[model samples]
Target chain A: MSTKDNPSESGRRNFFKLAAAGSLGALMASTPLKKVLAQVQDPEKPATNIADALKIPKTETSMPGKFPGKVVKVFDAQSVVEDKPVKTAAYQMLSDAMLQLTGAATLSEAWLMFVQPHEKIGLKLNPIGGKLLSSSHEVVQSVIEQLLEAGIPKENIVLWDRREFQLHEAGFTADAYPGIAITGTEKKDADGSYYNKEGKLYSEEMIDKDWFYFADVDGEYDDYTLPYMVNAGKYSYFTKILTQDLDKIINIPILKNAGSSITLCLKNLGYGVITNTGRLHAKLWGDTSAEVCCFPPVRDKVVLNVVDGLRGCYQGGPGANPQYICNYNTLLVGTDAVAVDRIGYDIVLKKRIEEGIQQEDSPRGRQFMEYAAQLGLGEADIEKIDLVEVIK
Target chain B: MKNTLILFLFLFAGNCFAQQPFVLRDDVLPDITSVNTRLFDKDGLWGYINGGADLYLEYGFEQVTVFDIKAGGIDYKADVYRMASPEAAFGIFSISRFKCQESARITPDDCLTPYQYIAAKGNFYFSISNSSGSPEAQVHLLAIAGNLLEQIENLSIEKPSLFNYEMLGPHLSGLKYISGQLGMQNGFVRWEPLFQQSKNYTAWIMPVKQDGSIFYVALVDFSDSADMETFMQKNGLTASNGLNQVVGNKIYTLFIKQNNRLVLTEGVIPESLRDYLEKF
Candidate 1:
């Protein structure tokens, strides 16, 4: 029945809808976008917090249900209209990629396979790479469109990242895309601190009190005293939204070469899901890239990972620089985060090796992948991964 | 592979490259003093390198003297990035080789863009981006590069003896010096996981083919023979003194410490490495 919800089959979709959406993007550029920010800011806005929501219990684990290390698909197209992500081309790439990854004959079937109609889905984006290299709005819109056609209400889907500033820098605000709840775990944008700019700690009520893990590494856990540590592994706390608000999380990470080696799904959700990530982060050298992503809270929540490799950077990144910016025009999709990252690491590693700067199997990122695989996170070896490619 | 034999002969020219240091003289570009220089220290490194500031910083970057040369009423931008040594200079230039297309017959050991010229000379890796893209600008770019290479010839770094350059079949043009974490992670050092960044070791990679780091012999120079041996002993990599210890997968990696230098060869037969080490 879910497979029968295709816009084409229902005749609900038309070309004019696309034209109107493009016009909306231009309009969003000029004005103070979505007015939903005020409503969602309340910790109790939805009335039912994560603790109560988990009791409504899901019978099934959602799409890509069991870490099916089956295959990672890559679809690339250089469709930049005046150096910007083109809507139609991006939509085509996403549709093709998702269908191939899930082996679904139709588009609507692919979406239903991921979530039930009433389930809340959170789309986590990586925006540290800034405007040009961050997650493309066009790509997000394509995903949103597919979700809408799948019978999921727009208000039920939330687009989130670690810091509000980075999300803003990535060019999406609550108002930017109306109906969708665009927000973050941190109250403000990254002010070089994990905590808010005002130095106030995030409310513990947002993190799942019982379902948390700690690396047990030596460091002062900042937000431990906030009465939220239902179990204080303190440093790494899963946000309440991750624990409660969304039933399925769609990891949308920017594909770029990182000083941390490669910032794909593993790094995006691993680091993005926790608090006091400062203890885990080390630029140029990977410190906690392994155990961070291996934690139960972050790993268990992610159902699908679609890497935004379209307009990405090759060298100086996860902090975007124009010089290293490349238009690979690719989208990599997979259920297994490590397998996807291992492939991403290889792609980025090949580029770095060509640049004569990096080598394969460096102790950091590559090792984290191996550790993830060992923990049954996903496939890390090239032999184990089945790669599907569609280039346009 | 014949490049190795040619490289063996080229190693002797290390002294030749270290001789000249002022190639950007008045003759290279008419009225060269009109070239204004902006000295960028660590704090202000971004003022010169921009996005690539941290790249140079990790390479023991000291300062960058960016010379904005005005000649024949054309603005030619030349940046002389000064690292700690010739190897650091070479390392900086090596990483910058990618993304540049349309190679000109300019610098023999450099990556040239359509409007830019890049090369390493002694302790300085320099680049010249010609805005005008005129015939006169091309001539000045070449002339300035040639003179600078000759001037800094004597300051060029010499290859460490551990590599046994004479036995090297032909892999010389693919060499660059580095000394930090970037070097260690890029096959310059064998796996230790806890590898520390240092200026004590001078690491350089010589890829086996066009673009690959997996199969290469990395020549690493330690402070002395004791230090080299101590590193081998401490890290349990001691496969020297008439013996060779091979490590790694995908590529057959061989690590041998002789004298003050450590030879890490990947993809080469361990049996042949003995004869190579004996030749040095």
Candidate 2:
């Protein structure tokens, strides 16, 4: 056993102290703690150092890319037929949406606008829902096919997420997309070990220590959470794949709800690119979703947002609950993440209202979008967005 | 006498540290392939469900044991959560279960959907799921849930005291128990603004229909008078001698606060519903 695998003596002492004070349960329970430990470094409420993220200079290709407030919504009833996605319909829908979005004469021209043959492109997908309600293979294949047709080499294109195993579980495999590199930050070896021979986490090396979202809020994780988080403290390091490997990122998130709010483009990119995200979700879910994108890695690299709504959950989601899953049969493409999410929120909210799940809109549901807009991420106000809808 | 006292203390401590049995034996369920159990406590819950842990933890989570089993040529994943209280267990169960296809034959409290079976019994809430949503898989899912339920000594599933009202019996399935903002957001979001103003309060909310109209009734119990007072003040309301009927923003609010408990009804209330609310 390596020393890195175990908590330091001081760390163990602090954990036990927190356990005795009932802070551990309170923190995990999301209960506001009144008692403050003078010696403890962790704050009662989550507070990330957004100042560091803001220091990075923004490029011309920074978020709200090419088309800022423009969102192209393409809905084909045949996109998902009887709970399954139609490959032909998916390809047609993507082609139509991209063409309309870029006003390109051809599909290749539209693809070329986002990426060049020389640049390494990354496809960030939401595969957390497994096979039941993940990003459909039809849509992913269509995106890859379009990229291939645009003269990008197969080796230059990568399909990735936070969890490698989940990406495989969702059927994003070597057999499926042979030449494209499929990878993740948190990966296990052939022997199913998340740790290397020296017992350091394989994910530990995958993180870039220099770049981190340093929050005043410290995370004290147990053994189980440590493997996923890689490290615990005030720092949440960005994955090397986002920081070092990829040049241009195309975010493909599933259209789903995380509570009242929709986890569309911003949520997927923000949470996916970093480590120690569990602490952020408790108090700063909206903040993390918005502020993490302000960093150069996410802000500058991510060029496009394509939401797979072909088969998504309208109610009980971000997780796949079969009953709540619906055939949205829709695809939303945009350069402005916030605009696409705003339009997606309206669609999901309308479904919730029509199903009698909710009577009226909750102000809290649109909070992340508002935060993202305020941070200069994109357009959050529906009135300001130029929505072009195509019904096929 | 001192030695005897020391021995008794050791026995009690040993019993306290004893593990909760989380396996389905061959005798209990025949033709089981294997059971792989994983335990999560406090912060460890983050690994189990990622961000979804917050909602469960907010409802006073203690610990959870997950069983990944291969049984009868079918893959089954079962999660058993031990919450702080029975109300906490039910609160999580209420928010998670949706559009139930039928009630599990094992217990009326269990909700059986096509791909999942969820139940809250005593201070424990558990869900068993299979990827295949076929009827064959559903049968095994219920059986696994039933066997797990039997192992739990406490089988009581108690509803809030307000449920004693006969008028709410028909809408029992729609009833939700909320503990915090996350629960408020997921279960009964319309009342999130009102609840956001206060803390240390648990609410039982339900929607009722009368004469082509829908209204919401929320029964809140605050941990202390200060919280209740703060909630009333923030929402701009005064505790009158009896039920105070306030009409604002095209919605009707009829509420009464006594000590730490408040029963409020909101939305477009008709004459008959108002009369019915007065009975409370």
**What are the models' TM-scores?**
0.59, 0.86
True-vs-predicted CA distance for residue A333, candidate 1, Å? 2.1
Model 2 whole-model lDDT (C-alpha atoms) = 0.79
Task: Show where candidate 2 strays beyond 4 Å.
Answer: A1-47, B1-20, B25-36, B69-75, B250-259, B268-280
lDDT of each: 0.59, 0.79
For each candidate, report its DockQ versus the true two-chain complex: 0.05, 0.49
lDDT by residue for model 2 (A1-392), tens: 13342212233244234434643433433221112122122355455555444434456888999999999999998888767899999999999999999999999999999898978799999998878888899999999999999999999999999999889989999998899899999998999789899989999989977567877667788777898888888789889888778888999999998877899999998899999887777667887898888877788889999999998887777877777888899999999999999999999999988876777898788988887887678999999999999999
lDDT of 2 by residue, B1-280 (tens): 1111111111011113434444364543446667777778877887767877888889988788777777677677888888888788889888877778886556656799878999888777888888777788888888788777876665466776565566667878777899998898888777778788677889888888766877777788899988988887887767752344574574546456566887777776555545655555
Could you say which candidate leads in lDDT?
2
Docking class of 2: medium
Candidate 1 C-alpha lDDT tens digits along A329-365:
7788888788888888877777666654554445555
Instruction: Quote the lDDT for B265 in model 2.
Output: 71
